[model samples]
Target: MFLGYHILTKFFKNGELSNDSPKESYLYYEKNAIDGDLQGIIQKLDYLKELGIDLIYLGPIFKSKTTHGYDITNYFSISENISSNSEEEAKAIFAKLIENAHKRGIKVIIDLVLNHASKEFDFDSVPKNLSVKTESPRSPQEERWQMSFLFWNLDDEDTREFLIRVGEYWLKNFELDGFRLDHALGLPLNFLEEFSIRMKKIKKDVTILGEVWEDEGDKLKNFNLLKKFKGNDAQRFTSMFDFATYDTIKEVLGKKNGSLLELYNQIVLSNQLNEKEFQLTYFIENHDLPRFIDICQDIETFYITLGLLMALTGNVMLEYGNEIALKGDQTIHNFHESGRVAMKFKEDWSEQEKKTFNYCKNLVDLRKVHSSLSSGSYELINSEENLLIFKKKTTYDEIKVLIYTGEQAYQLDKEYFDLISNNKVLKLKRGIYYLQ
Candidate 1:
């Protein structure tokens, strides 16, 4: 049986993560960057629900020094910077947030940094032999410090047990759905397999999403490594964010001369390489890269890209504020911080922002209703220099998406229902057109 069977049955009808269901739609929120307390997050659950978000992936909430919270100091305590005045109060708020989310049928996944801890992590309690000595500075200007990898000494029983306990404590006590492991590529494969086994033992429905980014060549080579890590019982991870897709989308959409055929070919190649049993999460923007709006500038191009993302198969993840077209970059001193901005609620949004938000909301709703767009077989119907047309077909339905980036308008011969507007027949201009 699949490990997350309970979650699949409870939230999805297909018994798997598919684009047709709301369960696969993930919204990433940075606790520190967003303007809200733990209670504020709870209050916003209804807003997220309205956006068709079923899973909320929170950036590191553990005690940390940085605004992004990647440099975790304590795995057990909530960050004081983003939480209540007292640790006890913070725990209460965290518990309430999870409870409220579950009550609304939404799952919660928090970021976990297992590779390394903050400089202030209490390593005195850990054995010296378990830590790794490095000459490289911890930060840009900081002095070098000894860092302890959770399983640096693979045979160390103490470290293994400690990390396992940490994983279990959150699931058991907080009733959390799972974790989004940070820098998963740097961690040991053996440890990942073991950790998955232990976590499944606690809650079979728990989901584990890893962050792995690399070039196409390295990614293909690493697929073998991932398969081996899963071993006989594939329990390591439910899925990984599709960085390969992100790279392709970035290359084509970021530049003015990016080819539509080039983007189609890249998607076809990545889909061919994906493992049958595992799912790949797709996203246009995250905390790491520059915002999508900043890269694609034009509103028409932005809508086309968003439409393509919604049409693609697999779980779709949207960074907070992406719907509003928020712009920022890595050049703002702290690179990650530039991309991590406060959530822009609809109350204070401009006309353009409102239009973008509505467009995204419609796409999310469309994906939920159309199984072909989410879990169907894909085919490249037509590919040209400026226009690319693709079809997603399942047993029950079929969806054809036409993307036009050229300056001239294009007309369709047949009349088909427009998926985006839900009112008009198919007639293409210099933008994205979806027909069903």
Candidate 2:
């Protein structure tokens, strides 16, 4: 069952508040963008609602030194860059933003970097030996050094209590729906279990999404690691970002002579391994990865790849401006600065961009209307050299998705309604086709 399903149903009558929308998608916003402030984001709630977005994963709003907001100095205070006023005023603005978003039926999940903090964080109570010096290799010539930033000594009772308090304070005070835990794999399993337990206690319907960018087989590896942290126990995290799926999609869609069979195998394997109740957050591009448009080289391939992502069984997440073909590449020197550029709106868009946006909006709408596309069992109908066909079926509905990456158009045997065009399509072309 989806987390917060019952509570959301009880609160909202129209079934819009539930997180189980097949179109449940996320948009990652950077704080430094042109219209990235809390007020600016509130002003654009209608844009997101119109795009069929169900959730907004705002990048860290806490006090931080870097533009990315990962190196947080104060977890309790909102960043001065995101809010130029007093801390209390900033909190008020954020609360108002949340109020507006909830009113529009869009959930908000803020980023929480629990693995590490900035060197400037006050750590006087913790022992000096707990501090660790770390360096991130930027390039062949340079490295960024981080000194005395503690990853929170999990063994210490005081540290765990403080962190739990932080989690509870935000959930209770801000009325937040959930949190996106950054670098979650780096944190100890014990800390995760306890943190999740405590946070859920405060708000039972609150969701927790962890950043676990390892192979699908690493769930067993994580299980083993948790055993080492303590004895055998159940995994507590609700879901994690599916990096394995992202990598397979990139390999097939981004490269020439990429195999459709390999991509099909990865999709099947991921479904087999993932837990039924725990959904994997799926995305083609994020702040850490290069844009799909930059790697795919052609718009047709990009749209086909996006269609495949939307058809997968999980919570779909799209980085900001991906629908309009925002292009950027992350480098060791610039880090993710290039990938985290400002978002473009209607007046700043081109003809091609508008087309891509409409295509994405159509896909999102199709997902929302069909139950099979959102939460259903998957079955592979056919897998040819350059063409792939699959079906997602629920008891009530079934959706068939076809993808042809070859040069020539492909023909179909039966007539079906094209979800993209909302017209009866008799044959398949050298593009993506969806039938319900």
Candidate 3:
């Protein structure tokens, strides 16, 4: 139910935006989309395929002069900077990519930023021209104390219409499999609710994923910058980035044996939501986080962390370049794009890096094999300062036990197979079993 991947290999950037080539800066690139340099990305498809990743989520690749394509000026076609806008050329490139991926049974999702258009967007009524006024007391935008919760004044009906039109245009023209909405918190809840409904009308199978950041609280409250009191219910987006989980993991990594109870509480909190809204995009470190290997300081912790993500029933995004141990101070715009460091694809990968890569690949494969891991029926088995354990049961009989921690290995109940190597049964309550 949860599809994964973040900031596409084609659209990643580091520091201030620049039109540099990926050669000059690994994450940087000129105006090139999937259609522009087909061979460039075509080569990397195998890596994702090998990882058993059937669903891919790409960041904005629309027409934009910036290295990152968040500032979208066009919606109906691929950015001219990246590819020819001719219908024939666009269709041909799309067909080839779709055919290739279908052969491998992979689905692609593109990021759609609906909250605000680029300053250069062709809209005549720009945010600057619009004036804020309380028209209707109960109007959704008016109900929120501010005329604009995001970039522009939502009070302007004209702006809302333009955004809605953009959504419809892309849905009809591109026939994309789904969308991973950017800044779902800034978007109006009513707008998204309607957009999701309209998308279904256009294509019954179209999926919608929202980039909803978790609010600062132990319990689920209003999403960050979302004002439910003012009728800005941002929770309309189908799924959100797992900021809550990421927050917990970040804390755990920085301090040894810290807040096991908090981690457990967060997981249980996520499980309580509706299944449709229950899924989270989980990751220890993403395009915005420092490298996972660097954060953990060792491969063993990374393996255990990887297991935790796969064992949970949610959509998990593995940053495109993270597999090769790409690292840098990626925070731009005050860490908005945390790990967008330059990449070195030409350099040979380390043996340890490849081993870590395969570990993730195997974990993903294992999740796909076990339905219980996908369909939630999970419970915390044991959680302590140094050891963590959980069980996922699909149909009462089909059960999976996931156990790992920073401490020496602990015992598990008999009948559990070593997920890494399916061999002898496991016994818990024993002495140290060093994780690293």
**Best prediction by lDDT:** 2
- lDDT, candidate 1, at 388: 87
Counting clashing residue pairs in each candidate, in order, gives: 0, 0, 8
Per residue, candidate 2 scores C-alpha lDDT tens digits across 1-436 of: 2211101101111211221212222122333334245666776778888988878887788876555566667878886556544788889878987899899888888888776677677455334444423334322221232442445555666666676677888998997988888767666677888988898888777778777653333334543332343222225666666676677787788765458877877777666544654666677777766668877889988999878877777688888777788766444245345565666778889999999999988888877877777677888889888888888899998988888887876777788887877788876667888786
Give the per-residue lDDT of model 1 (tens digit) for 230-329: 3343456777766766766877876665678777776766565345545667788877666788787778878888888888776778877777777774
Candidate 2 steric clashes? 0
Lowest summed-lDDT stretch of 10 residues in model 3?
225-234
Q: Write the per-residue lDDT of candidate 3 for residues 1-436, one digit (tens) a residue.
A: 7536554544432222222244433233432322223334445566567767777776675655455566666655565334344546755555555557667777777788766545555443324544322133333432442332225445467666556665666667654677888766666677777777777778776767766653334323532322231222223545566666667666675334366566767766665453554355666665445666666666566666666677667677777655555554533443435456544342466777677676667667767877766665767767777665566776633554544554454555555445555555555432212110
> What lDDT score goes with residue 429 in model 2?
67
Candidate ordering by lDDT (highest first): 2, 1, 3
Question: Candidate 2, which ten residues in sequence have the lowest lDDT sum?
Answer: 3-12
Q: After superposition, which runs of candidate 2 have C-alpha atoms over 4 Å from their true positions?
A: 1-35, 124-150, 214-234, 273-276, 329-335
The TM-score of candidate 3 is 0.77
Candidate 2 achieves a global lDDT of 0.68
Give the local distance difference test score of model 3. 0.56
What's the TM-score of each model vs. the native? 0.82, 0.82, 0.77
